[model samples]
Target: MALLAQQLRTPLSTINALAQGLIRRADRLSTHDVQVKAEKIWRASLRLDELIETILSYTRASAGGIMLNPGEFHLSELIKRVCREQGGQEPDRPFHLDVKDVPETIVGDPILLEQALVIVVSNAMKYSRPDQPIDVTARGEDGMVRITIKDRGIGIPERDLPFVLQPFFRGRNAKKLPGTGLGLSLAWYILKLHGGNLEVESREKRGTKVTLMVPETNTTGLSYSI
Candidate 1:
């Protein structure tokens, strides 16, 4: 699956570029329909690229090796970027972010964090109602950075919550959602590799909250209040 994903990346990139180029040349087109078609192609190509990457990440994780490019980044900025990307994909639903008492800098792989947060936030959006808001909050507590995402839609059953972190296991409430059931599992592994773990609390029909806890740097650790 990794090899297939690698092979598809080049062609998919080319396709995305071509679609964007066509959209840029829309003024030369004879009809509005042509422009719309080009735009749709561009969006679809982007979605396909994301799906391909997700599949590749899952495969690599299964092999017990997930590559990451580690660096120092602001946790709040990272959260905002992930939320923005997710919001773009889910315009129909409202998403909110709250950041408190977080350090401006943290050491970790930005790409990996982005991918992991994307998966979590995306899942929150997917399972929640269109009218309901997905709430994301981050704070520093007891030498750990805690980020929580809550969804006010169908919550995971108590029986299935334990298995939700297992690969390919989707909760009963999430069975109807469109997914390969690998997002949360992958996120859990990624967090674990970064000296963190996922904590989930849910009640059927009320809501679900997923808390991600990561150790803060020495500087940030000193500043921790709650």
Candidate 2:
């Protein structure tokens, strides 16, 4: 709770200060200046929205209110879309995608899958250096598909690796970073909800690799349960 409050305050303060500045300086500020500040405000609001949504997901899932709506969708298109969106935010960093071997279509909730991918990709960007690239690779394995996101960032500590998927669990090295620490936990939950699995392999100072495994068909036999 304290961590959540502290993280939320930073963005809220930015939004509040920028909004006030824009209103107060409307008469004197140049169009370009206004645009820049407005953009900052918009980005800060997005950060706040992500934080809120993550909290709600944690709460909802705990109460067994989360449900999966699986269906067939193009996996390549989804990967490309996520990379495009994330790349725009980190224009200096590159996202190399290799999904040719993955099935063209898979069965799952597209919206939820996208959210999980965003969490992983965004974390890769945030933890790694601006010059380092993010590698996303996917391939078929029997009836399942494996999507891997690898990053050349300060990897997780060996001791912390075991707890990385636990809610609100952050690595000692990542303590200085900006995050609520719920992303991996939520992403893991989403995968498990689809009868899939999330795996992580990392060596401190080397980098980290996250693999998401999902079936090509909705064989989980789960329904709209709350």
Candidate 3:
């Protein structure tokens, strides 16, 4: 975790400096595109802040004392926010959000949900080709809100897929990728705490898809037990 934190800090600091510079010169920018770029920079810096917090939270949870602050929020909005946060740097590989079917709201910890989705989506972008599109879809069914993230990347080997969710475990194909291998594990824990499960489907050389199924409500039609 220390290594991961060190690796992330440098880039985050650079982004922070860049964002500040842009903000200082915001009035001098003449074009709409320049202003948009400045906003993206600032948002990206904020996302890095959230990611850093998430890493700390996961570390604290693994130490066995962290608790969630649950609430109600729109699943679609959460997904969009995570995608926007992570995809800001990649302007070429457009994110295609397909909300063909989904619920307006669900009960869960918004911060935790956002962190999990950020992990999955960040991994998707990291492994996928620059020109390939990343797909995010949400749907409500059988009292659950399911969010799926798919990327056209070098897929995991059949034998290694089962172990991918384990903490600090990296696959043969993932050795070259820059990651701590804690994202999936953290995501799994977050979903489990929300009474949800994570599912994966992939074919070697084709692509990979991860589906996070979170319960919409309890049997008594309440968000939490009394």
Best by lDDT: 2
Q: Over the stretch 1-226, how does candidate 2's per-residue lDDT look in tens digits?
A: 9999999999999999999998898999999999999889988998898889888887887677778888889988999999999888767898889999998898888888899999999888888998999999999989888999999999999999999988889999999888988899888888888878899999998889999988788735342221
TM-score of each model, in listed order: 0.76, 0.93, 0.76
Each prediction's whole-model lDDT (CA): 0.75, 0.88, 0.77
Q: Can you list the residue pairs that collide in candidate 2?
A: none
How accurate locally is residue 108 in candidate 3, as Cα lDDT from 0 to 100? 74
Q: Write the per-residue lDDT of candidate 1 for residues 1-226, one digit (tens) a residue.
A: 5444544565577677767767788678667767566666666676566667877888887776675455678889889888887788657778778886798788877777778888888778767777789999999887788999999978989999888887767788776555666778878877777777898899988888999887664211111000
Candidate 2 root-mean-square deviation in Å: 2.2
- By summed lDDT, the worst window of 10 consecutive residues in model 3 runs over 217-226
Q: What stretches of model 1 exceed 4 Å from their correct place? A: 1-46, 218-226
Ranking by lDDT: 2, 3, 1
Query: Which lDDT tens digits does candidate 3 get at residues 1-226?
Result: 6767755775577677767767888788778857776676765566566567756766776775545677778878778778886777677778999875887777778887788898899889888887889999888899988899999998899999998888777778878666667788888877777788898888778889999988885222212210
Where in model 2 is the C-alpha error above 4 Å? Answer: 219-226
Model 1: how far is 185 from its true place, Å? 1.0
- Order of candidate numbers by TM-score, starting with the best: 2, 1, 3
Going through the candidates in the order shown, the clash numbers are: 1, 0, 0
